[model samples]
Target: MSRKLSGILNSMHEKNMDALIAVKPENIRYLTGFNPSSFSLLLLKDEPVLFTSKLDIEDASQSSKVPVEELKSLKDIKELLKGKIGIESSMTVETYKKLSNNFKANITDLIEVSRMVKSPDEIKNIKKALEIAEKSFEDVEFSGTENEAAAKLEYNMMVRGSSKPSFETIVASGERSSLPHGTPQVTEIESPVVIDWGAVYNGYASDTTRTIIETDKQEEIFNIVLEANKKAVSAIKPGVKTSEIDKAARDVIEEYGYGEGYIHSTGHGVGLEIHEMPSLSQKDNTTLEKGMIVTIEPGIYLEGEFGVRVEDMVQITNRGNVLNKLSHKLTF
Candidate 1:
């Protein structure tokens, strides 16, 4: 894991970056073991340093893999700044203005690119997160309002040591499921409830969606979605283009005359963030590689009707190793 620091530094050297400033929490956590409780910065060069505000200094000192110091002020940071400074593209404009005056600040995705591949520890954390989410889901009762079910599942995850839900707990039921990013509601649970949620453990995440169906029409859609999900997962392998995997799922749905219903990308890389690099979409051209973790979630949503989605996390290797063993079909 310490080699990640060296690898990124070598990348900076090749780019002629005199130094790099990192503020994005995930990137900071990737480089340093500690996730910041407040504002923090990572100064990258030959000898990297982690700077955290007074509020986070104690915790940062205890876990930060790199040297930790108090981030006194922006001006103090300026004093240490050098030429051709590289910064994350996700940096806030206000902070960019603070340090832009003295350095040749350039927006770069160096850290994100490096993080696309997972190390063994990262994969382990993601697996633990998946275990928490799946176990919580297994105990969810089909009876109740959408909000209540979501609340129960999340509380169960917390008891299992997941610090929080990686994303909003989605329990979109009935017609509301047609909305790809539907929020849970207080309304009564109905047939065909689409529950999409994840849990976070050790700062890594696991995302999965299981739609409970009762009607014949809903079952039809779910089977088609299941086929797409299976084919896509089967297609994941090192050296294959990410888009090809998406196409594999999309083609299956399109052949079934439901292409338009499959609204979103087939999947996306998962790690510190639910959505990251190497998106499994027709537009993304990144080649799949070993050690990358991603989700295969293909759904068919019919407007004014319910939606059916089947999602599972897969780790890229010689072949896709699906991390979720939960059955795709959920019933009362």
Candidate 2:
């Protein structure tokens, strides 16, 4: 059995869980190398088994590290499950009902917890993903409409071996930049373009944001955001609370009197999923650990005016190690 599977089994045993029914796609892929195209379930126990749909069974068998079986129905597998069964929190209520009968079902994050601290291979994949994203950004021409620019960026990433964009590419400019999660529009591109983008490589993901500044006010705001990003990145290290890193950035923005404008958390983990565990926010108290990769993104949005944001990926080790090769100060 793989070390990851062994660790999860040990954790389940410690929790008095007899078996774990993993339905989340990422969890299944993490445990077994198979990325299911359709719904799949991994029953984790002494000898783990992957139950995949008929459509994916052949592929799953070829890719999965564990034994693969065709899933006929929930009834067929329900009989196999016994004792205290562990289910993912993301399991739908309907699905839970289908399997919880005659057994004690408890929501568990055993797989996700294991995924938090990346292995060396995982880190390498993330770095490659970041490289693809940054290189794509460098090749993009920020002319034409905002949507066109976004399309060009995405195309660049795909051609550069990215399976796909990690998330929707944001190319908001001018007043639209004031919207933190703004979508690229068809209107002509404007100054102070706020581009937030990422790319995926071999299932791992990378996230970054760079705002192209034009005027003095934009530069002023950009510098403040950059400072906040630096402070946040500097605070990343093993044993530090995620919230403290958030404060490190929040303080800089608040001191600059953009507290209200600085919406959203400091950052989040980046891996197979764009957003993962240990969110850099006030409410989350997760302590940073070595081998964890996170993003340090700070922004200030002025209503009806503009916004500035600087984002970079950071790896937590003895200290913070930034993984992005792209320059923080990007220009057209």
Candidate 3:
């Protein structure tokens, strides 16, 4: 077995876990190197194995580093469990109940915790994904409706070799931009448009957000958001709490009396999945560590008016290093 796989098995043994049941697609891909299209499971132990449907068998066989087996049903999985099993906390309650009847199941985030720190190879994939996303944005013509702009940008990413968009492309314009998670609509482009987009490359993901401002008020909010993003990035370092990084950015907006407008967490870890552990939010206490890549996005939303957000991918080394190369200021 590879040293990394053996290390994970050793860790599981230390925790008194006979097996780790990974249901999250990202976790499955992280351990096995196979991306599943339908439901799949990974049982991690001394001899790690992957269970996938018939449709994914060919892909899994070609990509998976470990042994791959055809999955018939949950009943088949239940029979495979021998002793105490570790399950991810993100597993749905319904699935948990269904799977917990026979085995000693305990909720664990062992895989996610390990994923917080990126390997050198993982970082390279993330950088490539970011490069594709940034280049695609530069090629897009921002002179159309929100939906058209989003569609064009996504097409560019795909043509440039991204398997797909990391998430539903956000292209909120004008007042709609104020909604932090606003989805693209058929509305015409306006004074300010918040474009939050990402792309998937070789199973890794990159997330970034940029706002194009065309009004004085929009510029004001943009500056505040930018300042917050900068402060947050500056605060990232080994051993610092994730919440502290969040406050470093949030305090800036709050000091400007726009605290209430900042509705979401400052950022989150990105890897095989766009969103992962070590969340930079008030509720998360994960400590910063080397080789971790996360986003530093802060925003200010004015109700029924407009909003601005500046986001960039940050690599936590001995200090924070911004991975985005594009200039923050963009105007139309």
Candidate 4:
């Protein structure tokens, strides 16, 4: 086993736990290095093992660092448990109930906590994914309807080596941009378009959002968003709380009278998945640490009018280091 895997196993043993059952696909990948398409399970202990469906048997056998077994039924898994069992908090309540029948079960975030800090190889993969995503954006023609722009952007990312778009490409244009999570539509592009997109490379993900502004009002909002993003990036340092980072960006937006318009959290940790731990939100108290990769995205949505968002990936070192080199300002 790798040192990281050994560390996680040692931690489990320290807690007087026999084994940890991980169901989340990202968690499974973190420990085993295999990305499962269907249902999968990871039992972490001294001799870790993975249970995957038949569909993934070939892929799991090839990519998984741990031993793989065909998952037959819950009854079979129940037989594998020996002592006190641990489960991820993100596990569904139904699964928890089913798995807790015979063994003493406790909820734990062992895998997620470990994933907060990225390894050197993981960081390199994320950086490469970001490069592909940024390059793909430059090739997208933003003059057409929102859906057309999104389709073109996704195609560009695919052709440039992305396995897929990290998420549904957000191509909100005109007044629709005011909705923070607005979906692309058939309507023609307008003065301001909020393009939030990402790319996946070798299963690692990158997330970024940039707004193109056409008029002074749009530029005004864009400037405020940029200011928030800058402050948030500057605020990242070891020991700083994730919520504090959110406030740093929020404060900038509020100072310019767009606080209410800034709806979502500052950002989130990104790795094998688009959304991960150490959420940069008011409710999250995760402390910043070295080797943590996160996004510093800030936005202002002037409901029913227009919106602007600026985002960039930042890998937390001794200090915050922006991973993306693309210019924030984009005009057409």
- What is the lDDT of every predicted structure here? 0.92, 0.92, 0.91, 0.91
Q: Could you say which candidate leads in lDDT? A: 1
- Measured with C-alpha atoms, the lDDT of residue 287 in candidate 3 is 84
Please write out the lDDT profile of model 3 over residues 175-274, one tens digit for every residue. 8988999998988888799999999999999999999999888888888899999999999899999999999999999999999888999999999988
Q: Can you give the TM-score per candidate against the true fold?
A: 0.98, 0.98, 0.97, 0.97
Ranking by lDDT: 1, 2, 3, 4
TM-score of 4: 0.97
lDDT of 1 by residue, 159-261 (tens): 9999999999999988998988999999999988999999999999999999999988999999999999999999988999999999999999999999988
Q: Give the residue spans of candidate 1 off by over 4 A.
A: none
Model 2, global lDDT: 0.92
Clashing pairs in 4: none
lDDT of 2 by residue, 68-147 (tens): 99899999888998899899989999989888887989888788888999999999999999999999999988989999
